[model samples]
Target: MAFEQPLDRTAPSISEAIDHERGRQESTLGMIASENHVSESVLEAQGSVLTNKYAEGYPGGRYYGGCQHVDTVEELAIEHAKDLFGMDHANVQPHSGTQANMGVYFSVLEPGDRILSLSLSHGGHLSHGHDVNFSGQLYDVEQYEVDPETGYIDYDAVASHALEVDPDIVVSGSSAYPREFDYERINEIADDVDAYHLADIAHVTGLIAAGVHASPAEHADFVTGSTHKTIRAGRGGFIMCDTEHADDIDSAIFPGAQGGPLMHNVAGKAVGFAEAQTSEFESYAEQVVANATRLAERFTERGLALVSGGTDKHLLLVDLRDSHPGLTGKQAEAALNDVGIIVNKNTVPGETRSPMVTSGIRVGTPALTTRSFEEAEMGIVADLIVDVLDTPDDDAVHDRVTSTVDDLCEEFPIYE
Candidate 1:
């Protein structure tokens, strides 16, 4: 039997928007650090009929019936996650990385528990304890900052701060940080402070899986991550622990944070983890880092000051202060958007501008790497981005860059 949908008959506008979004993806470069293109198989799994079922509880102990097949999906996802991260146990629920962090916090942290995390403008995630996020509102939050001169985490300073605050939990991870973290150092700091160490490896899941970067699973007490970023999985989150806290983690994700699991997404996670297990995925992950390195080199060669001087991962933060002093991140982001090169405005270390109008733009190479882009092509793309920033007011240059991007997209068709 074949499945077919007359989307135009039921929802023409929504279908059109979906198609248009696909077109946009195919035409434009997606430079967001936290985004990637899932495979067609993963997409199929995510859009499957499993969405109709509600799997509220764990496999073989669900509150609802008819979850036998979805149980297999979730179990496969869980098993793959354990193998992928080399963890003793895995929970493939939580809906997102934010919720995964929430699950870890709920499992161990009480309301108003002391928490120490990296500051937002310095590369930490909002869920880490931003004033607007639940983590902040519920916990007693303290933040650490990147070193102004180096644009990187100051481990010594972090240890000093950790000792001063004596937090119940110390969070290590970032949304826009490009360099690899010293997980061992952080673990030591947490141990010294007698705090739970939670590593949110949401941004570098693919690199860690590929062994291109260090794994936080072996060092942190709890590990939470998203499946969608560099992992090339569909949108979802997961938690990893040493099996001693498995029950509590599961309980936190289920009753404490999220309700029913999205079984279709579980299927997608299974499929994606299977993909990540292959040697091809390892090569892809390597290329992602190489491309990012190439992009950063080219950007620096173009006189754009890169945060931390360079990246050891698939993303980079470009500080436009010295290079394009008059141009705000918002302005640069808009100029890049006009030329079909997508990037996000982000706050740099010691930022004076607001978050919305940041002094930095964070660029990444994951989605492009998924589309089979390599270092040489990444060099060209970086030049195109710098060209747009250089002549933001020149329509002719924008037209040229736009056409070049179109050519590049044609050369690297996502579906083909």
Candidate 2:
């Protein structure tokens, strides 16, 4: 299917804007932990005519007519997701991971029920009971923190907190955690308290699918994820659970939170899942981790302090206090962005600064890995970062780095 290219006279001005954005992405280093470049197949599916459908219900039970093709697409998406994660059931309808989490909360917990989760500054997500979100507003929220010294989650402390709070549900997972999670331990704690366990593996779903990360599908009562993160699918979300809770999850997602599903994104997700099932995807997943480890090692060699001392996953949080004492994460982020390397400012464990001006920066290798960058390039990228940080006021250095970045990106050539 060929998309019509707009003639110069009739073209929307947004065409330039889209092209500009794409050019920027192509020329820069994308180190955001939650971002990845999707394959052309996924993009093709996302732009397909399936977006015109209004399939308001599940397969064979739609509220609208003319859903036969959409029904097949959605069913294929669900089946592929189930096979990808080894789950008994799948629901690929939520517009985002937060919505998937909302559905899970609605499925089991009542308003004002106690819920225990990790603190956002300590690597938890906003939907995991942050005060500004509905999860905290509607439910009684108690948060656990990582150890101050080790900068890692302390299960003993988490268990103690859970026992004290006696939460109705225990949520485990994170947005920026660098180490492996102990799902079995979390499950045991939840079992001891007779509480439900919900694991939001949005960031690590691709790794889990590729057997690079531990699988929570077998242990957690409920699992939620975003398809776009490491999965490299189009924008969408999904939920999986034990077959016993399948009906409740379906009801919660459909009638409780969202209406009709985006069949186009679902189709894209199906394609991503099928791709993930291949051996090539496994190699990509392994390289993602390898690149991340190499980056972490480079940071250490350059005298940058890493949170939790190092990373065991695709992302690492750098504590800037040691290398650039007075420079906030906000400043470092801006400086990197100026030189075409993108990353987000984030709070380190026990941070004294505000979220807007955090103490650390979160960096990842997924997008770079997706562009086929290897461990050697990771070291060079780290050196560039160190040099930029060391000479923030030098435009010559920034200009030179930006030129080099453009050349490197040209070699990688994303979306060709």
Candidate 3:
């Protein structure tokens, strides 16, 4: 395949842009739960000649000409994804998780159909049913929330709500809650309500593939996930389902939702899927959990209040109510960013503050774990975080934390 090379003097150099991005990653500690650094092979595939193709449709059925190579790439991506998740069929074309959800909704629901899902404030994605999203605007969205006291999903409550709502679909999975989901139980609830079960494993796809987390493919009727999060691929989305819904799902993603697929990203997804099939990827997934646990423990020991008391996956939600009294999540996020620790402010369950100024921060170990940081290093990171939070005004402490973070990051360099 002949790829178009950028004219050297036509624009800001692509090499310069790449170098700047690499510098940003090298200098900062990325602690966002929904982010990760993809492998070089994935990057190469994402930057390949496949990007120039205009394959408006699926393999062997393009709406445009010259799609032979892209067809091969997309087919590899779909097959590998199906094998990885043990799904009967796969759709590797959604532009994002939101789009993936939108396609699913289009496939199985009408404009005014009642859809039940987890509450956004209680760890659900925006596409699941946030009032501002298309899902909420088009459908009658009823939300199910976690128990405030236990910080876990109340299945009994969820069942009752499903029964009352009589939804057309019941969506499981979360963006923040730290625990394993009982997919079987949730599926049973959906079955009793005569609703389809859709599991969004966007945050835990890597763990699920590594055998560290439960696979929802066998239990849920449909599953959607992002390739960039735990999967460590380029930014994109995928959908999987049983054979019965395969044709409908594929049609929904194509003609029903998006037009031409980004063949470059599809190629990257194929590379990522191949990488995940290896033993090393399994080890990486296990370390992601271990690093998160270590970080959580360190924060607890330092008197920081962690949501749900701790984490069972690669992420932690720290409630700053008690430790940093009067400090908002926005302030904390800014302060931490100043010290080279990148995390996002997030809402806690029943938060008093708005989404922009949350009362909590979400942190994750995936990127650090990708850099090969272990338990001991996580303890150091915990101490640095505590120091910064305790003395946000101290420039010296911030500088020290920055320097220490730089050094630690150097010890476990990425993309070298």
Candidate 4:
């Protein structure tokens, strides 16, 4: 069947915007730590006819009719997730990582339950416990910070804080942190305090699945992650837990949080998850970390101060305060954006700048590694970023870097 629609006529503006966005992606670098490009097959699956289906419940036991095919898709996604992450059960219905977190919270905690998580300025996420987010508003929250000198999460400090707060749940994992969480230690702390450990591995879902990073499935009571970020799967969320909590987690997503599942995205997840299980994917994951390490080395040689001094994963957080004094993260982001080298301004440990204008920038290698960039290319890219940061106001520098960025984008085309 010819499934193409007359999008040009029906929605010209939207179509044009999409075209421009595609052009933007094809031309610019996507260095945002949380973002990665999906495969063409995943794209096709996400745009399939399954989008029209409701599929309000889990596989087979749906509330709507005509769900047999979607049932198969969801089951494949769940099975693939379980196999990849080594979890007893997987729930793929949550619309986003945050929604997945909501399902977990709804499943176990009541209103005003205490949540102990890392501080946002110290590399945590809003969903973990920021005042503006629902989790913070709904729960009594206490936050721990990375050690100022070492720029790493101090597990001992976390233990002390957990003991003092007596949290109902202890959240591990981070969004912009360069180092890894000691999942075992955090889990032990939670166990000692009789608190549930929720490890939100949204950013490192791919790395964990590839076995390049540690998996929290064996340590945490609940594991939540986005299917896209490093995993390069569908643009949705998932939850993994023991068989004991599977039913509650599933029900929480169905009736407690979101209404209907996005079955097309589920199809995307199935395809991407299948893609992730390959030896090629394992190589890709390894390259991601290698490229990041190269970036860290290059950035350091160029005099950029990394948050943790280095990364054990695919991202690095550059603190502009020491390296480029008086230059705000917003300024650095604008400088890089002007030259087509994409990155995000972030809050570092000991951050004093407002959230709108942070003190640091986060750079990641997943998208570039997906483009088949190795250490050499990554080193070059790192130099380009540092050059922009070094001379934000120099037009000659901007023009030169822009040419190199265009060349890199052309050489490493995303879809082509």
Order the candidates by lDDT, highest first.
1, 4, 2, 3
lDDT of 4 by residue, 1-416 (tens): 23366888778899999999999988998899998999999999999888999988888788999888899899999999999999999999888999999999999999899999999999999999899999999999999999999999999999999999899999998899899899999999999999999999999999999999998989999999999999999899999999999999998998999899999999999999999999999999999999999999999999999987999999999999988988999999999999998899999888889988999999999999988889999889898898888889999999999999899999999988
lDDT of 2 by residue, 1-416 (tens): 13465643356577777788888889899999999999999989998999999999899999999999999998999998999999999999999999999999999999999889989999999999988999989999999988989988999989998899899999999998899889999999999899999999989989999999998876799999999888788788899998899999999999999888888899999989888899999999999999999999989999999999888889999999989998899999999999999999999888899999999999999999999999999999999998888888799999989988888899997888
Candidate 3 per-residue C-alpha lDDT over 282-318 given as tens digits, one digit per residue, 9 for 90 to 100:
9999999999999999999999998789988989888
Total backbone collisions, model 2: 0
Better of 3 and 4 by TM-score: 4
Residue 309: error of model 1 in Å? 0.2
The alpha-carbon deviation from the true structure for residue 28 of candidate 1, after best TM-score superposition, in angstroms, is 0.6
Model 3 vs. true fold: TM: 0.97
Angstrom error of the Cα, residue 393, model 3: value is 1.0
Residue pairs in collision within model 4: none
RMSD of 2: 1.9
Query: For model 4, what is the C-alpha lDDT against the true structure?
Result: 0.93
Which residue pairs clash within candidate 1? Answer: none
Q: In model 3, how large is the Cα lDDT of residue 268?
A: 90
Return whichever of 1 and 3 wins on lDDT. Answer: 1
The clash tally of candidate 4 reads: 0
Task: Provide the TM-score for each candidate, comma-separated.
Answer: 0.98, 0.97, 0.97, 0.98
